[model samples]
Every structure is written in C-alpha cells, then in structure tokens.
Target: MTDNRVYLFDTTLRDGQQTRGVDFTPADKIAIARALDEIGIDYVEGGWPGANPTDDRFFSEPPALKRAKLVAFGMTRRPGRSAENDPGLAGVLGSKAGAACLVGKTWDFHVDVALEIDRDENVQMIRDSMKLAAKRGFEPMFDCEHFFDGYKANPDYALSCVKAAYESGARWVVLCDTNGGALPHEVSEIVAEVVKVVPGDHVGIHTHNDTENAVANTLAAVRAGARQVQGTINGLGERCGNANIVTLTAILGLKMGYETGVGDKGMKQLKKLSRMLDDRLNRAPNPHAAFVGDAAFAHKGGLHVSAVQKDPKTYEHIDPELVGNQRYILVSDQAGRSNILARFTEIGVEIDPKHPKIQRLVEDVKEKEFLGYSYDTAEASFELLARRTVENVPDYFSIERFRVMDERRFNARGQMVIESEATATVEVAGQRLHEVAVGNGPVNALDLAIRKALSTAYPSIDGVKLMDYKVRILPPPPNSDGTDAVTRVMIESAGPDGTMWRTVGVSANIIDASIMALSDSLTYCLLKSGTEAKVDA
Candidate 1:
C-alpha cells in the first residue's frame, strides 16, 4: 500500500448484517464479497464466524477474491479465557481468512459494567488476541470499540488499550465510534492524540450514523492522519447504520485527493454497487443519498437548470459521471423552457428551444402535473408524451373496453380469499379480441387480461413483466374532480433481457390510473424491442 493510499475496509457483511431486517444468506455473503473484491476494496470483513451458521458456512467456503483480503471479524477472548483456547478466537483462526479483526472494549465504563472485568485484564485481552492472530498467520487488526467515548471518560485507559494492541503486533488499530456520538472536531482532536502513540498509518476509523454524522466523523479522522476507513455499503448496520463507504470513497478519492484502492475506474462502479445491494434486499434506493442517489445531481428550478446546462460546476460539486451517476433535469410546474429543452436533450429527443412543439409539450406536461402526474420520477412517461407529440408512434392496439371485479369467497381449502378478475376487449389488425384473466389484485388482473388479448398477435408481449408498482394519493385536482383524492401510479417493468423502464399514470380512480400505467409499461417494452411497428401494420 502506498503511504498516501487510504485502505477501504468494507464491513457490510459483518456490521451491516446487524441491521434489523437484513439477513444475508451464505450465498448472499459470497456474492457481496465478490462484488467488493471487484470494486477493489482493500479489505472485506466476511462476518463473525462462530456466531451463526450462515457466517460459518460462508467462511468454510469463502469466495476466491481477486483483489480484496477477506477479513473475519470477532471479539477478543473473554475475561478469564486464554486466547489460545477461546472458541471465538479459534473460530477466527479456523476461518482461514488472510486477516482477522478483533473488537475489544476500550471504554472503562464498558470494561467495568459490560464485561465486569478489571481494566488491566481488558488490555491483556487486546494484547493476547492480536498476538495469537499474528501467530496464526493472519494479519491481525484490533478495533478499539467505543474509543472516542472511552477517551473522553478515561483517555489514559483508551490510549493504553491501543498501545497494547500495537505493541502486540496489530497491523491496524481502528478507533471505533461505536455509539456514533463523536462530532467531527472531537474526532479530529481525539484521533490526533491517539496517533501520537500508535502512528497514523496503523490507525483506522469505524463509525455509526446515529447522529447522522458518521461520514463527517470518518473524514475528520482521516484528516487527523488515520489511513484506513471502515464502513458499509449504503451505511447498513444496526440502528442508524455504519458510515457509508460509497459516500466516503467519493469524498476521499475525488474531493480530498486521497489515494484509495478504488481508483478512477473502480469509482465508476460505486453507483452500480450501491444499487445492487438495494436490489438484492428488495429495498428502494434513497433518491437523495449522496453520490449514488437518483437525485444526487438532479436539477429542478429553472435558474438552476439553466446554469447547470451552461456550467455544471455552478450547482454540482463534482462530475456525476465520476461516480457512475447522471445529471437529471426535472420538468415540473416550476420549469421554464430551459428545463423542457434540457430534459428533452437528456432523453435523446432533439427539440429546439423555440420550436412550437416545445411549448406544446411543456404546456401539456405542466397541465398533467397539475392533475397529480410527477414527471421527475416518471421520465419514461414524459419521453412517451414527447414522442407522441413530435412523431406519433404507431398505436399497436386500442382498448375497446375493460372491466375488473373483486370477489371474496372461500376456497376449496375453506380459506377466505379475495380474487380479482378482469376482462378486456382490444382491437388489433382490424380484429377484435376479448380476453379475461384472474389475478391477485385489480391491477394485476388487468395487466394479465390485456397481455392475453395481445400476446397471440404480438408474441413479444409475453416477454414483459411488471417488476414493481407504487401508488401515491394526491389531493383532488383543482375544479375538475369533486372526489376526495386522485391516484398516481408508477409501474416499473422489465424486459426478458433484463432491461427495466418506469411509466406513470394519474386518475381519480385507482384502477384507472393503474391500468393506464400498466398499459404504458407494456407499450414501452414493445417499442424498445422494435416489435410495436411489426404488429400487423
């Protein structure tokens, strides 16, 4: 490792699994380990081996990493146990990882209350654990758990714990803000003091996000001479989370000019890696997350959009492409013609600012948005609207009529069940086809019925699948509907080849909005597949 290179230690599989609803299987751990290696992370902490079967199985057959060192995490030996005989220590050795991280209580309060052990014994624990790990042929690292709070309470004891680990041959002694209560300035000052004894090159920083300052604190530690940063993907951990490595990587590598293993090329994979974790967990990505979020570089206001179009540095801090994210211009009621043109240009639709169709499309978008359509999250819908206005796409089929009904009844197993059925009549190739299908919900039934009606004529329709659906209720539009609310539906669809697209619809009736979006999703898939124009033209 270069002297200026800050090592990235990913604890997503170990600390991140402490997240309440997160439970990564053995395979999930292996897959994530490989992704981290591919991204060139210096250290990948697999998990605590002896604690659970999943982690045990993972260590038993860890993936063959190309670049990253697979590190196993565990605690130091218990109060009275010898390090050589401790099961936890043995498990770490048995893991066969090239490196091992042992977390020990650095806080006097924790040593007195949590472990009920003498302070001297705790120091011995840290010393013995590091010595044994090194003797076992693993690169030993010690995590000074609660180091900041411990330093504040008893600076001498915390410093002694760190010294013990270093004197015992620890390759790295990580200062952990276990409670995540340290402010940036405090972290800088504390780390500065700690490094006086253990050298900055041997220091690392691990922080939680309870106060939402984990990222800030990590950077402060780095500025104070820490060389290694420990965090998780998307900040996954217990409670608020650990520091977000994705955000930290960008700031350290791009902003601070620090060298990380994830150089320019690996930085481009940051967004994809973040999204992959969310996808595997079936969780939605935070649109506003720094660096990798959907709206990280999105501009909305007219003035901001105009300035960004000229010079992105006016608003954006860094080039979004550096982190594999793109700039987005949102068209809303606040949009000027500049917003419209910028949005069109982004979607590859060339429209002059003064074109008559530009004003028409902008007006239509504003009017529809007033009726509860959000173009920002539904760019695919806006693109279809623009395409229809500039050069009308061929109508593959037209809906003659449709109906959906829900019936609650007892199944043959005598269990109560609610079934939804939909029937649709569509015109295709001058022939009318009527189809009916039952589904779990009204929208699903409608989707099934429409696809059944068109699949025989356009076999390509069979390849489309509705991947996700979201519904948001908005206040009734002004003066048009007297009802209590209107519904906006966003549908995410996937093609057979794994291409995904999103479409949006709005109406006073939930089913109506769902059907509109669902139909648009199918139509968009067909258009992209180049099969819409081939259907009995």
Candidate 2:
C-alpha cells in the first residue's frame, strides 16, 4: 500500500454491538458484514466466537466476503496460561477468520489494578498470543489498550508493549485511546513518539468518543504516521461511542487527500449504508449527522438558500451528492423566492421563479405553516400541495364516512384483551365500497379497513405497506383546552419495489390525523407509480 493509503477497519459487529440495547442476531451480523464488504472495508471484526453462541454460529458459516478480511477479536491469553492452552486464544484461532486482533494491557494501571498481573507477564501474553495466531496462518494484529494513558504514565513500558507485539510478528500494532479523553495534540504527540520505535506502516489508531473527539484524534494519529483507523458505523459503541467511520472515511478521502478502500464510487454509498444499519436497528437516522444526515445539506434561511442556489460552494463545503445526500431548499417563513423555486424543482415541479403563482404558493405555505404545518420534514405533503396548484391531482378515492370502536373484555382463559374494529365507506371509480376489519389498535384497524375497501378498485393498493407511524402532540392554543392538543402524524409507506416516502398530517384528533397522513401516503405511492395517470386518462 502507498503511504497515502489508509486502511478502514469496521468493528460495528463487535464494539458497536456493545452499545446499550443493541444486540445483533446472527442474521443481522451477516447482513451488516455483507454491507461492509460491499462498501470495500479493509477489515471487519467479527465478534469473539466462544464468548457468545450467536457469534460462534456466525463464524461457523461466515458470509463469503469478496473484499473485506473477516477478523476475529479477543483478548490476549490469560495470565499463567500458555497461548496454546488458553481457551480465549483457542477461540480466536478456531474462528477461521482471515485475521485475528488480540487486545492486551498496554496501560500499567490496567496491568497492576485491572488484571492484577506483573508488567513483564502482560508483555509475554501479547507476544505469545500474536505468535500463536501467526503460526496458525492468520494475520495477527495487537490492540494496545489504553496506550495513550499508559504512555503518559509509563512511556517506557507502553513502548515495550507495542515493541513486543511488533517483534512477535504482528502485522499491526494499534494504539488505543481506551478512555477516549485524549486531545488531538496529545494523540499526535504520542503517536509520533511511538512511530520512532515502530514504523508508521505497522501502526494503527483506535479511539473512543467520550469527549466527542474520536475523529479528530484518529486523524491526528494519521498525520503522526499511523496508516490504519479503527471505528464503527455511525459511531455506535459502548459509552459515548466510537469514532464514526462514515465521517472519518469522507474526511480522509475527500478532504485529506488520502486513499481508502472506499474510493469515490464507494463514497457515494456511505449514506445508503448508514441508513441500512439504522433500518435494521429499527431506528431513525440522525438528521444532523456529518455526511449522510437528512439535514446535512438542507438550506433553510433566505440568504443561505439564495447563496446555495446560485453557487453551492458559497454555503456548502462539498457537493452533497458526493456522499449520497442531496441538497434541500426548505420552505418556511424564512424562505424567499429562491427557496420556492429551488424547492419546486427538487420535487420535480417546473415553475418559473417570477410566476405569480410562486408568490401565492409561498404565502400559502407560510400561512399553513403558521397553522402548524412543517414543510421541511414533510416534503411529500408539500409536493401534493404544489401539484394541486399546478394541475389537477387524480381523485382516486374519497371517504364518505368511517367509524372505529374499541372494547376490553375478559376471555374464557380470564385474560383481559383489548380489541379495535373499524368500518369504512369509500367512494372509488364512481362506486361505493364498504369494508370492516379488526386489529390490535384503532390505527391498525382503520388502516386495514381503508385498504380492504380500496384494494378491489385499485389492486395496486395491495402492494403498499405502512412501514412506520409517528405522532407528536403540538402545544395547545392559549384559549383552548390544554387536555385536547393538536396531533401531527407522519407516516412512512413503502411500495412493493421498496420505494419509501413520508407524508404528514395535523389535526386535533389523533385518529383523524393518522387517517389523513395514511391517505396521502397511499396517494403519493399511486402517483409515483403512474397509476394515477392511468386512472385520470
């Protein structure tokens, strides 16, 4: 590898799994491993095999990766045990991974206090374990846990620990900011000193994010001569988190002029990969995340929007598309004509900036926003509003009436069960259709009834599925009843081809709001599928 080339080691399956409430099933680990391989990661740390049954099964039939080297992670051989006899070391060897990473105590405090072992014995452990792994035909790497803090306290001992691993035939000696409290300058200083004893090509950096400086520290280490960086996707890890490899990769490739496994093409998939992880975890992506967030490239202020529209470089440091994100011109009270024109174009509507209707639309949007509509987060709803003004939206269906009932009753087993039932009367294609359904909740029942009523007239409705539903209660008006607050519902729907979209609705009643959003979601799906065009014709 060239001096400018940096290796990306992803530990999302191992360290990221250490996060609170995060437990990846064997299937989830397989999926994430494939995704990491697809993105050209250098090394993917599969978890400790013998420590957990799930990880053991995962390694038993590891996913066939084309690019990334599957690595098994474990601690050094136990004190007073031979590397060959230690079960932990045996587990790492039996994992059948292409590589093995063994973490050992580099900090004297951990050596004396945590492990209660003599300093020389810890060095022997690192040497023995790494030598054993290499002899077994696996590329071995050593994680010098708490190297920075240890170096600060006992520089000679920390350097000896790293030296021991390198001399033991380890391919990489990674310095770790295990406590995650080191400043960038401190990292640079320590790494520079270590490279004097060990070549930079043989060194790597692993950092945590307790002080929110993991990325900075990792970069600092690189500048000081480390060639590899270890981190997790979206910064998911134990405590505060690990360095976010997504952000680190972008900065390394785009800004710092370093070559990573994820080249320009792979960089475009970063956002998609980040979102895929969040999807598997059933969590929403952070809108403000560095490179791939929803709001990363969004411009809202009038001056900022105008500047970005004229020349994106005026406001944005880089093209959003370079990272699989797009620039968004948000419409709000702060929006100007530039914002309106840019937003219209983004939603595939071609309206002249000078058109009289553009001003009308701007004013209308502002008034509706004052009435509790947020166009920034609900682009699907904004598109519907814009399309309605420019052309007639196909009137696919209309609800004449709907009724929902909820009841709690004890069953023969003496268990109390709550049931909800909904009935819907819908007018579709000049025909009245009635349908009823029962569900676990009122929203689910209403959604089922509506879909049942319309599926016959529009068979394509059967392909649409509601993926997510979120409701927020807005503050009540000053003179209104505080107990009855307006609700804003955002529904995420997906078509059979996996095309997803979000629609929003607001009303005093939660059910009414949910229904409105659900209808809009289905309407948008039909329109996008061109079914609405066929219906109109």
The best candidate in terms of TM-score? 1
* Candidate 2: worst-modelled 10 consecutive residues by lDDT: 528-537
Could you give me the TM-score of model 1 versus the true structure?
0.97
TM-score of 2: 0.95
Writing each residue's lDDT as its tens digit, candidate 2 over 36-82 gives 89988999998998989989999999999999999999989999999
lDDT of 2: 0.91
Query: Against the true structure, what is each candidate's TM-score?
Result: 0.97, 0.95
Name the weakest run of 10 consecutive residues (lDDT summed) in model 1: 528-537
Over 4 Å off in model 2, which ranges?
A: 478-484, 532-537
On the 0 to 100 scale, the lDDT of residue 257 in model 2 is: 96
Residue pairs with clashing backbones, model 1: none
RMSDs, each prediction?
1.6, 2.0
